[model samples]
Target chain A: MSSRVEILNDGGYRSDGRRQYELRDIDIDLSQQGTADGCCTITHGLTQVLVTVFGPKEAKMRSQTLHDRAVINVEMNVLPFSTGERRRRARADRRILELAATIKSTFEPVVQTTLYPRSQIDIFVQVLQQDGGLLHACINATTLALISAGIPMTDFVCAVSGGVHSTSPLLDLTTLEENDLPHMTVAVMPRTGKVTLVALETRLHVDRFADIFRLAGDAGQALHKEMKRAVKSRATRLVGAMETGMKPPMGGADAFERDVVMEDKMSF
Target chain B: MISFASFPVPSQNETQGMTRHHPDVEDDIDMDEGFEEGFHRLTSPGEPLTSSQAFMRGHGTYIDNDEVISSVAGTVERVNKLISVRAVRSRYNPEVGDLVVGRITEVQPRRWKVDANSRQDAVLMLSSVNLPGGVQRRKLESDELQMRTFFEEGDLLVAEVQAFFADGAMSLHTRSLRYGKLRNGQLVTVPPALIRRLKSHFLSLPCGVDLILGLNGYIWASKHVKQSEQEGEEAFDAEAVYSNKNDDIDDATRLAISRVSNIIRILAAHFIPLTDTLLLDAYEWAVEQEGDVKDLLQADIGDAMIATIAARD
Candidate 1:
């Protein structure tokens, strides 16, 4: 991860024109899928994640089932076409394994797993398009997918990465931002405001750990608000499907057929 | 889902009096002929929160943390701060009173299942379809079927959200003259939430373009429909709304409209997230100066995307 010329401007703005602890443009699409039990699409800078949840039903695999607690299954895949440069068309790589683990660990504690004992909940997240924060996005998407599925949860898990870039602690680094910054992404549950999952890909000064965690946790909370709002908006629009039969459009055909009313003015 | 009105060009008093509950007339409804085209650059809340904002969405609350707090003190909906209580838990399921537009996915015995971009198939019962004559009530006859065979698989439609059953599936309706199948024109879909709580459907004309906006944030561009309301209080139904009116609107008008649409489509293709106001202003400025236009596209759109488009051009 080169291209990080520590913009020697110290205490100044970082790349992409951000100050210390600044997040990127994080718009979200809460209900991008029609078939999934729950769904959300998160875009962190250029990074995009589409998450779908299928069940709190019977666990598909016998080997993974737990006797008393609801088991969680997390899958994260990076689409080959997501990157700017052409890459392999293979399935999920090693980085995805770590991410899947991060998502599982981050969410397991928050989900009220006791509600559905003997059942397995599956959170499937795909990186439809990728740019940066590949892992962070998967974590956030999983939380949304869980919410959409209406599984019990204590609070939202919001995640963002912060790193030392251009001599500044850059928050929510993009692909370009990540290249130069030695950073770690943190997933936090804002209700408790605690970091449940933290993946530090590069070594950094240990003294500033507290500050980094604080910035990333707050950033995660901000992201949670956005994802939550988007999902609610979509869920509202969805109710349109349920409200049928109220108008009675052609109901009176059996009742009013012979009522004195027939005028064929201009049949064309 | 194309809106036909613009954001309100409110008098100073109207603008000042604007509260969260007292939405502009265009809010929660489509823009008929009554809309104003204008623009205002509103500042974003502190914190570049595109990431955390995503999480805030699910809970019915958003961050004002560390800096920006709630301007509107209401139940915090994590998804959308603008409209509270719409989706924290399910509020209004598909109901008959709601005016909605959807697409046809399957046709069956006396019914069709529509993909309203929802969880399940929205059933369009045969009995819910509106027949032509008001008093001539009869079974949906063969002649009536042939006359209005407007939809099929893949066909887009505009209907109302009617009601739901015990199983949580939706039943849709197309009773009025305004609601029915759509054809000929394009169908642009944004997140449905954007449609439900739009502050204004009127495209701000800070750059001067007549924009017909669907309640769903689907924008239709045409120079012929320039200078605000072309007609007064004349509401356009689904049938007429999708008509290729741009073709008949006039040549110079078509040219301008097409140019604007072209730019927007290109921007959308690039996946440039935009507000209606921002896109119109940017396109106008880019075209106003020919040399600048080239630089503009090149700047935001990487060279590779530009090259891909240029090869086709």
Candidate 2:
């Protein structure tokens, strides 16, 4: 084995010091981004992705509209500096297109697109930083963005990546671990424990597949808890804001300033 | 299964009191009860709201298995036995008779497509608009060729939702004098939820600015036109109404317009619903600060303005 660093240490900790079943720390920001109906910036460890959702509004292209349902158009852009290599990928890059396609398909069954006919829901995913688990971050962020935008969906789709390092399975593998291990990303709708997507690029033993899949699904449930809390708090804050002066000013100025600063940062 | 009967219902007198106040006050009371009974409980997608057998699902909800699962992240509301979730943020859902400000996107054969921030671009049929000479003028073939003169693509106008087509697309009409061709104005977009239906959607401020509060969240702030100069049905001047030229605006009026627009933008950023009283107070606060119109956008000043307004309320 040409692996310079040990994937798992003697203490049963991975290179990032996480245990076999431990996932990366997740950070979610479901704030308004310009005119987007819903927007979310999610970070999993060092991987960061920003997803903005616009519409269920008029379809820009008449041909793309469906007579009985809304069409979802997913456009993804991976910033050249997102990865250590700093390579610029063309808009039509096959891998990027494939990832976008994967995201669109994953959300198709979850979002109740039938509610709005002859309209289009645009999901714009921007990969800000990438260490690993890029797909997981994108899918999770898109889910939150859709929810915040008030797009109806059957359930929240929580995604997490799992890998098999030798016989042991590791959750939320970093770039280094992902490069050297057989990993797969799983997206699950937490309500019914239904698996929406299972994307595997590397080969893994048949027996190991079931274990990682189940582990990823459980991790997705944990992710659902975090996402649900964020959405609930956001809804509560918005409802409170809409209630006008009925309640005392609760973080009104502070929150407004934060939003202004965030908008300024996004402009760059 | 949780029984909703145990929740305290508002008495008849309370409802009467609600009617006596502003219509929006009734909404506030309803929300308060929603909070108390947990009927307006915050729910996320996939959350099981209630048994399908007990309730009929409405918008933002779908029946899955035997339960009515919420399809959106919002507060779950129940009207009698029909349960629905009103999304906190979404595209404008237009209703009949709503005044909206829209920009023309396309001029079709007999209808003009308008970007009204709704699910679909609202259609403004030729028959729904007033002609140049008079209100009751017959449709002429020459007018068909000169549609661009009336409302070319990209012209902003104020209109009312006349009706809806079978596909849920709203049809708009600009037959009223106050409804056509916006000029000497600025359009500021905000979330539709922030605009409450008031006694009147039109307001003329003391600062020489007229405001049109579009229910679709499009606000038009322009130079106030005097009532005497406004054309009536008998003197409908199509040339002036459809004219692309902007009236010469003096510097002070321009300053006031920007200040009003900026104030509206700031209030919207804070997610505060725009009421004439609240806006008047905010404007007064802005004028007292005496900051530059651009400076009103600054974080500190904007925060102070919102703080002052909230305190006053």
Candidate 3:
């Protein structure tokens, strides 16, 4: 490769100092945003995305209503400052529309739309920052937002990006590595081990696909643990508040300790 | 072969933990034991609850491979052989014989579509309403043409869910004199879960203000109407009931209505369940503070009010 930055060093560390197959740290915030029914903001290292779910309510347009199930509408907006170079994109940008359509199809089979016939569920996704794995973060954030909104879903969809740097398979790649390597994003429903989405933008050797695919699946399970922990804690705090009639402490100390233990268990 | 070093294998303890939480497995230890009343068994989507052979699935749950799994992130509730999960935050789920405040969204030929904060716009049929001439009078064809005269677009009214259509849309009725157009009030919306059912949804305070707590999370606070002026079927004045003009609301009553509305808003922001007793106590607390009605919305003041209420409880 003619790039000045090294994708992988002699010691097996990447440019960001993460070893092969190491995932970026994830931070999730599940807080009420404005009047949305459910909202979530997730950060995968420097990449950040906020998702808000509005309905299961009446459809705005009569033509969009489905007689047997709810219609899912996804709208995505990438802020002009999200990328390294400052640029403005139109509301109907071709790339953004395609991304929104991809997300809508990914969730269609998972959400239990039949429960609310003749209704609509609006999912608004805002991309705050972009590093790499933008699609992965959007999918994960949307899942959390839908859960928080109390929408019925068969399972949680966890996603991660993987790439083959030369012959070594890397998990959760950054923009630098993504530019130099052949990468793909994979979303999995952890419980049933169903692959909901597999998006590949760059070409890769057929032989290398299986290895990266399996690695991404395993990484999704790890990410599932992180998301589950966040959902459980938020649920517990809300239940506690409702029961005791007081504001529950922010992420109780015991909960934080348990998270640490879980993290230790995850690191093989 | 390249070794997959980063991923952790599902350990024995983790697998056991899953089975241990299942209701059927827990049943074996104590046949007579059940979840404590008000105890919340929090669960997330796809978390298996019990074997379908031993329990029946309820709302927020689905049967998959002979197992009952939750489909939302909420508390697990059990009633005898039925298991269900109640989602913490969702759109209002309507039931029969419940009071709701709604705004007219569309005036159809014979029905007025209402925004009841539910999954679909509730239908209010012309036949379900009290005719202007009399309670039992037949509806004339001319009435259908002037539906807007009674409930034009954007008019707010309080009604009860009378029935449901085959498509799950709730039908509302305003046949009773108590249920009709709302005026001289402000509407405040909150999560439906915060409003609970009570003996009477219509509440009056000593401060010359009245409140209608719609189970659909639509709260209306308005000036108190004297019981004597609230006409019965004998003296039903259709002109007054469907009047577009608001009565003369004095500055004192107006201030009290705003104060009570603010209190309700603050309590809802704190996620506290609203009840008649709670509202009365909150109103008294606000008056004792002697601050402007707008001050109750201040973050610190709201926190103080919640803390005060919690301590008293």
Output the better candidate (2/3) by TM-score.
2
Task: Please write out the lDDT profile of model 1 over residues B1-313, one tens digit for every residue.
Answer: 2221111122488436534333345335322222112211111112122344333333222343422222111122332433222232221235445555566777777788776644445778877775444414576567335533545677666666678765455788876543555432334544333333223233323333444344333444434332233212234333443342333445444455555655554443333333443344445444555543334434344323333333431
Q: Please identify model 3 stretches exceeding 4 Å from their true place.
A: A246-268, B1-38
Ranking of predictions according to DockQ: 2, 3, 1
Tens-digit per-residue lDDT, B1-313, candidate 3: 1111111233578546643334336436434434565566888998888899999999999999999999999999988889999998888999999999999999998999999999999999999998798888999999999998899899999999999999899999999988999998889887898877755677666787878889999999988887767876798898899998999999989889989988887776666777655666788899999999988877778878878877766
* Regions more than 4 Å wrong, model 1: A1-11, A32-34, A239-268, B1-313
Write model 1 residue lDDT over A190-212, tens digit each, in one string: 75576788889777777767778
Q: Work out the TM-score per prediction.
A: 0.45, 0.90, 0.89
lDDT of 1 at B155: 65
Q: In terms of docking quality, how is candidate 3 classified? A: incorrect
Error of 3 at A235 (Å): 1.5
- Note the DockQ of each predicted structure: 0.06, 0.28, 0.23
DockQ of 3: 0.23
True contacts kept of each: 0.00, 0.56, 0.44
Give the clashing pairs for model 2.
none
DockQ result, candidate 1: 0.06
Q: Rank the candidates by TM-score, best first.
A: 2, 3, 1
